[model samples]
Target chain A: MSAFRSLSLAMLKGLLRDRTASFFTLVFPLMFLLLFGALFQNDSVSRSHVLQFGEVAVLDEMPADQRRDLSEALNVEQVRDRDEALARVSDGDADAVVWQDEDGRIELRYSAADATRAGTVQGLMQSLVQSANLAETGQPPAFELASDQVEDKSIKPIQYLAPGLLGWAIAMGASFMSAFTLVNWRKKRILRRLWLAPISPGTVIGARIGVSLGMAFLQTALFLGVATIPFYGLRLTGFWWLAIPLVACGTLAFMSVGLVIGAWAKTDEAANAALQLVIMPMAFLSGSFFPLDSSPDWVRAISNAMPLKHLNEAVQGVLTRGEGWGAALPAMGGLLLFAAVLTAVAARLFRWDDT
Target chain B: MGPLNVSNAAGRPEPGATRGPTEALDAARPAPPRGPAPPRFGHGYHRQVTKNIPAIAVEGLRKRYGEVRAVDGVTFEVAHGEFYGILGPNGAGKTTTLELVEGLREPDEGSARLLGQPSWPRDPGLLRRIGVQLQASAFFEKLTAREQIHTFAALYGVSSRRADEMLETVGLTEKAGTRDDKLSGGQAQRLSIACALVHDPELVFLDEPTTGLDPQARRNLWDLLREINAQGRTVVLTTHYLDEAEILCDRVAIMDAGRILRVGAPSELIAELGVGNLEDVFLQLTGREYRE
Candidate 1:
């Protein structure tokens, strides 16, 4: 009884001791709420321009002649030179830049200063180019878009930023916590010591799972508490209550992945890197940064395998679409499956020490 | 069937120089009498006492990491109550072998038994019977010695109201409240040993127990370990200091590249290799080659 008590206390103390980890796990996801809440509402960016880079950067290297047509863009300035244009845009000397690539394409570069404004710019440019592109000419000539009512589909900064922040909290909380602790035990050769005793490997893994799961839940709660403020304010109605457990469950699901990473790597750094390897691409693809609904179908499909996709989708349903766990059940189910698989793998592959 | 096995360290390789007496030392220094003499292992830990039924039976132990064969076809056994040592240079699969024996890993090709039972059964009850001190261990950084001891003690279903008392046993009573991460290397090592002992295990494994400690600390650990052995518990220890092994282990095995080169008492191993000391025997068995 005392040993289990001590184990729980020890695990908690370990979490509290890591200042940086604590901040990331307990603070940052909701910080985005506060930061973005104050910045990117429709009223906030009523007149801002949208810059579409991946699609509209085509004019960046267009011959000086074709570039001349882009001056008509909203807050539109087609900076004639790439480096100078980039500098002005980067330093806020210009609201945005418009350029085309070698393929006789249309492109836009907006100040990344305000992501909301950037998204607004991105939304504006995408619509403008989509409606006016003259493929026969192999370029979209500069044209003023005159829509009395421009459907402003620019995502709120909070909505855009929430998924990635949440995903990071889940991935980081689990990965680092497990990796460092696991490898250190191995390096120290403590597991081997435990082995000479009658203790089974299952007990060791169960204890670790209990420890990491508790931490995972704590990470979610911290993020939720921080969410109470406005920019990061809780946008959900009663349905949000349902998403709470879903999100918490998602956090545990992701932590299981971290456990696997920790179990597989021989060194602490390797374990950490292994976690990032799993996290970075998944976070980007799983709509953690932006809604993947607009992304290609295949891209969206890949996200199904990522824990963050389910997590962000859960958040999106309750917070954005005003749905509940019933709506997010598919993603939640996927998360549970992922959790079960990862836990099994971590347990199966676990080593007692750094052998 | 035993006190909680909180800190039993499984064995690994260490240097065993300045060999002890071949047969005479078994009867040389005696304090507390041990159980009936254990039979020799499949081969032996270090010397040929005899081929005894093993308390730990390792058959064809093997491990692989992508491109590296960490442990390959290594086979050995450890008799109950023997002060066994596995001696080898760094990266010779000694630690890997120990991990397999301890049931941390599943054998890729072989089988291991702990007291006549398959070790991979994942029994919590089994851990309560062993005490271990690892080679490169870590504890909860902010946990005071008292806290760490109590916590680990609970995992194996044992309780010690005296975490501080255990610390005192390890000569760390004054520092019991300090966080483990703040302890000096030697102090940390002491606390680790204390963690392994708080539950009073019957079989204790110590992997490279004195790798980084100063001479005084090493000597202190040796005496402490001797005192532990005097309690009639089996001690399976590993170290790089040949003199320490010679002085401590009743039986020893020389391993190189995941294979046991020889096994006998320190003196017997040296005699078998026809060398003057452990270093000579080691040199004769394995020429100077940097093994990382």
Candidate 2:
């Protein structure tokens, strides 16, 4: 126990003293958060651009104020030539093309190249038609739609971004730290010296993992703490506290992944290559930066298989969607299973020295 | 005196001579006439009820990496408190042989017994009795020299005061707060040695501790090593420097191509081979210029 404690304390001190490691683990992801937060500062910012080439009655009949409000979410531009509008959408200049058929029915056409924007355009078109149909009756309906955010708090892009980015930060800190530490120790022959000590290898690894987990939790606190500042406008809600346990579960899983890479790679370059191959693709596809709802089915399918995807979803649900254990528990279960399997693989591949 | 007839050419008193069991073993066997001879291990000597065991004993130990025999069929012994050195050129299997004996790697064949206990299965009790310093110093990243030895001390359940005393013993008290990477090459080597001795183990192993140091730094480290062995601790070191082995070791093992060409006190090996020095001793054995 004393050995484990001293080793963990020493490692923690080492991490704190390593400026590059501290910057990459604790500060880099926050930079990403600030950048993404600033880019999507306004919640009402238009998501998709649509070109209306022909007279579409539903759009034409819309009130001026209502049209202005709709334009806030979707860029509706009127164009003269059908061919030109279709060409623009095909070339990815615009998201979709809107026209009316002889039957006076609204027709929306979109390109498959930008699947995420195409999905958004389709949803807006459906809602536009539905609202038009209801307004055509010109009567006060007995039942009306009443929509409000969960907990009645106005939601912003930062609120959604906070949880996803936090999950991402936790994954980065845990995995990279473990992988680099292992490879460096092996390269430096620290493992051999530790083997000569009275302490067991298990104790050394335990201390390392203990330090990694502590850094992980520190990242969680920093991410949430920074996001909750009034400037970022991230509001933590019901079951938001569940993120603590979820972060632990996710850190363990990613740390195992890192251990496997560290154990398999013989040098720093090889470990870097393996880390990039594993982490970069997962980050982009896991909906940490954007919603998977806009992604294509195949992309979403790949994202679904990634542990980071589940972590983002669970974190986003609790922090923004006002969800409880019902939503977070399944993700925790998946993360635990991921950690268990990867841990076994890490143990199988673990080597005390590069030789 | 305890049955392997290699004489001490330096005529120094037997290290740890006051130990009761060694005196008993000396009485049980007759001392042979002085001569230039390689040291040998009495096969069943340690199995006796007496505690007159050699600090290290290995017989026909071997380890192979693919087609290369890294430590092919080597055997040797070091008496208690003896300053021993394995001298060889690069890739001469010195490190591999040391590792096999240290219980850091399992031997492909044969056995290594440390202080009368089998080292292969890695007996934990034996670990407490031995210290190892690798060719490359291995420190916790970003640690200060003091913290490095302190953590090592903590692992062995040694006191922080003792760890600090070890720092002073290696003349590193002023550099105690210096980060390991910021230290000079010699300082790092001394810090590693301090860490190795922090627990005050009965046996210590150092591999190529002075390979890269300047002459001044190398001599400083030689003094520190001498002090360590003078404290009645068995010191086994491997080095490529022929003169270093001659200056520091009580007995040196000359190794080439994963085999020991000669093992005796430096003067004895030189006299027996009729060579002027160890460098000529190497040239006579391998018929090649000795290379670092």
DockQ of each candidate, alpha-carbon based: 0.35, 0.58
| Distance from true location, Cα of A329 in model 1, Å | 1.7
lDDT of 2 at A5: 92
Give the lDDT of residue A47 in candidate 2.
Answer: 53
Model 1's DockQ score: 0.35
The reply for model 1, stretches above 4 Å from the true place, is: A2-5, A41-168, A175-226, A229-235, A256-266, A270-307, A340-355, B1-82, B88-97, B105-123, B138-142, B254-292
The candidate 1 chain A region of ten consecutive residues with least summed lDDT is A143-152
DockQ of 2: 0.58
10 residues in a row with least lDDT, candidate 2 chain A? A142-151
Output the number of the lDDT-best candidate.
2
TM-score, predicted candidate 1 vs. hidden true structure: 0.66
Query: Candidate 1 lDDT, tens digit per residue, B84-196?
Result: 88888998888878777777778788987776666675565666777777666646656787877877777666656655577777887777778887887778888888888
Candidate 2, B218: how far from true, in Å? 1.7
Candidate 2 residue lDDT tens string, A99-184: 99999888898999966567667777776776666566664351122111111223467866887788788888888888888899
